[model samples]
Target: MEPGATLLNSTLQQTDASVSLLWTLTLVPLSGETPRKGPATMPLFGKSHKNPADIVRTLKENMAILVKQDKKTDKASEEVSKCLVAMKEILYGTGDKEPHTETVAQLAQELYNSGLLISLVENLQVIDFEGKKDVCQIFNNILRRQIGTRSPTVEYFSSHQEVLFVLQKGYETPGSALNCGIMLRECIRHEPLAKVVLHSEHFQDFFNYVEMETFDIASDAFATFKDLLTRHKVLVAEYLEQNYDAIFDQYEKLLHSENYVTKRQSLKLLGELLLDRHNFTVMTRYISKPENLKLMMNLLRDKSPNIQFEAFHVFKVFVANPNKTQPIIDILLKNQTKLIDFLSNFQKDRSDDEQFNDEKTYLVKQIRDLKKPAS
Candidate 1:
């Protein structure tokens, strides 16, 4: 046997063994309530992974190969997608605490330093949605992993603001919108990134994006919008306070949107933001406005039961406010009969919701017992 032939045979065997291992690991069977940890569960390297850096190098190389081959779709990039998923599993571990190893922590830092994350963000535009989701799942794992007190990926991206700017640009494409939205929401856990996004002009585009003709992308953008406002209550309150006129100007448009889903979901998120204890000032300012009340009132007449139900919750806040402004009082007073009639028959579908029933009863009384003022 020639020396070159022996070397080639040995290399082929190693490649075959690795492929076999990947197949076995990916096909592990589920047997119980708890998740099963298949072989090669370590970050980067498999179970026998000796060096974490090698695993990072292999993932980066595979990612580069996939990037070069597929500029149009990810369906044909199954092998590359599988490799990414396997890396995620290894880094995240089977259970919550199991993968928080020292090596895994370093793996997070190394991936950041290697610039692979930027490549993943850029690939969102070119890859198919499933491939994009695989990339997002990896990001979710990174954001969820903590080195000491915070996520390494979050820490890295906090300073690398340009990556986030590109990620936000994903909203421009339907194929990438949902994946980028998910990754952006994960990044919001780090306050610096959150503040940058909230303060930037990207904040204004949210309303338009949420109204996109593409339902999936629109809904995903809406979720990201809601996450930004609700995830960090204190920060959101400050933003709303500083930019209330502009933010709610757009938000009210969302409430008046012809899209039933947008109207309903925005109403629901509005209720959440107001009812949250941290948003007292925001809630006070919001319910004080009569136009907002009128918008909620019109929403009550929406044909969709879901929209009507959500609208009822928000409308109750305006009536329930003790310090209602004259403008607010005037709207409620003029519509007192209609409001009473509406609440009388409102939310019968929620007859079993005791709390809702009590609230409805209270709101009706509040409207019924109203005064016509000194005039």
Candidate 2:
């Protein structure tokens, strides 16, 4: 053979050998065949596999080559999509004569661990609601184990990019919404995910889920849910302006709940929603009521520091406003002891952080001013 032709043949043989190895490793378990542990046996087309570790190492190396080569080819991403589709079908579709649950589960875990599943989910955009719903079902089943069984899955899915997909796609169906609620509830138990999810566009979808009946299953869904509520001040302000009556009705009902945590969360959400210029007129009606002030005064003594802080902050804001200042003054005269105690505790426990110290100083100044001699 000519030297050039000989070189081309050798290259083709190596390519074929690598491709064969990938196919064998990826499909052998599904085929119920114990993996073979040596070279291809064909001359000039063999790839030695020294051991199980060697097989894995060779498989990873070949996968990288395949990905690189695919990247160079026209429509390589399309080909990859097709491969993913075929893999999904084999794992999720029922058309196969007999599905290998163990192999499929292993592949799902491997994909999740490598972050390929998350990447695939990010790339996914289905215009068809039904198709989106089906994908969500599969994703939910795969992630359910992670959400319920493993602790890390909560953090993993709470990633901004990952939860963004859930927010964008999970609202397609009621079932998907429930799945997202479950995931978010687990995520909020940890601070990192909670912080990310609270500020994300996903938060709107989260509120939507809470508005629906599915919220009953995850009561702690809003345990510290109030903290996130304060972050979206503008959005909450807008929502309250348009939905004040509905919100007030729900707030009233929530206050009667046996779960003090939920009640405090509702109050905090209400406070955030009402802490805007637009809602000021309507909020005055609630804040000025003697009974409402008493309720807030009671809340100031709640065991949860968050509830105490939020109640005092809301009271301060309401009293600072020109329209509600007199009613607030009246309440303060009636509950001077409680107000003094709260201010003293707040100042004593205040952190040295400049911002917190500034707030503490401002509160003390406000309290001093409130006790000024009458003209």
Best by lDDT: 1
Give candidate 1's error at residue 268 in angstroms: 1.1
Candidate 1 accuracy as lDDT: 0.77
Q: What is the C-alpha local distance difference test score of candidate 2?
A: 0.52
Model 1 lDDT per residue over 222-314, tens place: 888888898888898888899989988888888878887888889899889889988899899999987788888888888888888888888
User: Model 2 over residues 2-70: C-alpha lDDT tens digits?
Assistant: 467546545755476575666545344547677565444434413321222332233344344444564
Which 10-residue window of candidate 2 scores lowest in summed lDDT? 45-54
**Candidate 1 residue 277 C-alpha distance from true site, Å:** 2.1
**TM-scores, each model vs. reference:** 0.75, 0.41
The 10 consecutive residues of candidate 1 with the worst lDDT sum are: 41-50
- Top candidate, metric TM-score: 1
